[model samples]
Target: MKLSVALIEPEHEVNVGHIARVMKNFGVNELFLVNPKFDSKKATIFAVHGKDLLTKSKIIYFKDLRKFDLLIGTTAIYSNNRSNVIRDSINPSQLVKIIADSKQSICFLVGRESTGLNNTELSICDIVVSIDTGTAYRTLNISHALAILLYEIKKNSFQKKTNLATVHERVLLIDYALKLAKVSGYRRHKTSLLAMALKRFLGRNLLTSKETMLMVTLFRQALLTIERKRRKMF
Candidate 1:
C-alpha cells in the first residue's frame, strides 16, 4: 500500500516543513502539496533530515487528486447528518484498521491552518476522519495533524509483502469479464451490473498479484466453456 500525506493549499512554510519532518519519522516518503505558500528554503529549515520528502514531493491540482483510490480528509468539526458512516473521532488503532482493510493507494489530506477542509473538498473524500482531542477548540496545526495521522498509519499495520496490482491489471480483469458476459448473450445492462459486482467482489478480497493472476486464468477458462456451449447451439 502506497501512503501519501497531501497538504491542500497550505499557507505556512514552517508548517509544511514540520509536516515533512513528521512524515520522515514515521517512514512516509510521499509528500504532496497543492498550492503551497512557501518555497524550499522555509520548508528545509523545519524538515531537518526530512528535506528529501520536500524535494521529492509532488505538487498537483485538486482535480489530479482523483488518481488516488482512497482519499481521507481530516477535519476538526463533524457535519451532523451529512455522512453515511460516522464514528467517534478515529484513534490511532482505528486508523490502522481502516488502512489494513483498504486495498488501494491512500491519501491523507490536511487542509490549511486557518480552516479545516471546506464542504467541497470533504464531498470528494471517501471518509472524513478526525483526530480525537479533548480541547474545546478542536483545531490542530497542519503539521500536528500530519504527525498524528502518520503515526497511526505507520504503527501496527502489517507491511505489504507484495506489490498491489496496478490500475491496468484491474482494468484487464474487468475487460475480460465484460467480453465473457457479451458472448453469453447477457443484456448490456445486466452485463454492466455483473461486471460491477465482480469488481466489488474482487476488491473485497484484496487479492495478491499471484492470486489475481490465478483468478484471471479461471475467468479465461469459464469464458472458453461458454464459447464451447455457444458453438454447440449453432
Candidate 2:
C-alpha cells in the first residue's frame, strides 16, 4: 500500500512543515496541498530535515483527488445521529483494519486548523475517520492528527491481494447508480441520501477493480433498459 498526505487549505505554515516532517518519518513521499494559504518558503524553514518534501509538494485542486485509489478524510468531530450521515466516522484503529491488506494508494486528507472539514467537504470523501482523543476537547492539532494516523497505518497495515478500485472508478459507479435511480423514478431528495450512504458503504469495504466494474456495468444496463422501456411507452 502506498501512503500520501494532503492538507486542504491549511492555515499555518508551521503545521504544513510539521506534517511534511511526519510524512517523511512514515516513508510517505507525496504531499498534496489543496488551495493552501501558507507561504512555501516560510513552511520550509520549519520542515527541518524534511525540507525537500515541503519544497516538492504538489499543489492540486480538489477534483484531482479522484486519481487516487482511496481518499481517507480526517475529522475531529463525531456524530451519532444516523440522519447526520456526513459526520459519521470510524476510528484510526478501525481504519487500519479496513484497509490493512488492500493493495491501493491511499491519501489522507487533513483539513484546516480552525474549522476542519465542512459538511460539503466531508461528503466528498470516500470515508471520514476521527481520531479518538477520549476527551471533551476532541480537537487535535493538524500535524498531531496526521502523526497518529500515519503511525497507525505504518504499524498495522500490510500489502497483499487484488488491486482495489480507484477513486475515479468508485465515483463513476456511484454516478451510474444515481442515473439509474433517476431513470427509475426515485425521488430527488431520496436519491441524494442514497448517494451519500452508498459512498460510505463502498469505502468501508474493499472492492476489487473487477468487482466495481461489474457493478458499474449492472447499473448502466439497468439505466439503458429503463430508458428504452419509457421511450417505447411514449
Candidate 3:
C-alpha cells in the first residue's frame, strides 16, 4: 500500500519540517500540505536530511484527496460526543488490517497544528483514527501523532503478497461462502454468523487473488453438489 501524509492548514513551519524528518525516519516520502502557513527556510532548517522530502512534498487542495483510495483523518481529541457514526474515530492499532488488506493509495490527513481535524474534514474521510494519550495531556503534537501512526502502519506493511485481493474479490469470497452454506442445509441466522466470522478472519489475512479464487471455486463446487442432491431428494 502507498501511504501519504497530509497536513491541512498547518500554521507552524517548524513542525511541518520536523514532521518531514520523522516521515523520512520511517521511510514515508509522500508529504502533502494544504495551504500551509510556514516559511520555506524554517522548513528546510528543521527538515535537515529530510529536505528532499520537504522539497518534493506537494502543495495540494482538499479536492485533490480523490487521488487516494482511502482518505484517513487524524485527531487528538476523540470525544464521545461524535454527532454521528461517520465522526467516530477508531484506535490506530485497528487500522493495521486496512493497510494489510489493500494495495491501494492512502492519505493520512491531519488538520492545523493549533487544532485537530474539524468536523467538515472528518466527514469526508474513509476512516478517522486517534492516538491514546492519557488524561495528563488530552492531545498530542501533530508530529508526535504522525510518528505513532506511521510506526503502526510500517509494522504491518511487511506482509507482502504477489497479488493482493481487490475489494471485489474480498467481497465475493464471503458471498460465495454464504451461498454454499445456505444451499448445504445451514440456517439463515447461522450462515449469517458464519459469514461474519469468515469476513473477519479473511480481512486480517494477506490473501492473493489466486488464493481467493481457489476458495471461490471450492464453494461453487460444493453448492453444485448440494443442488444435485436436493434435486434427487425432491
Residue-by-residue lDDT tens digits, candidate 2, 95-145: 888889676878888999989988888887778999888889999999999
Candidate 1 runs further than 4 Å off: 82-92, 101-103, 158-234
Q: Write the per-residue lDDT of candidate 3 for residues 96-141, one digit (tens) a residue.
A: 8656635677788988988778877876666778777767576888
Looking at model 1, residue 147 earns an lDDT score of 81
Per-candidate TM vs. native? 0.64, 0.86, 0.67
Which one is best on lDDT?
2
For model 2, the run of ten residues with the poorest summed lDDT? 157-166
The deviation in Å at residue 124 for candidate 3 is 1.2
What is the model-wide C-alpha lDDT for candidate 2? 0.87
Better of 2 and 3 by lDDT: 2
- What shift in Å separates residue 45 of candidate 2 from its native position after superposition? 2.8
Computed on alpha carbons, the lDDT of every model, listed in order, comes to: 0.72, 0.87, 0.77
Between prediction 1 and prediction 3, the one with superior TM-score is 3
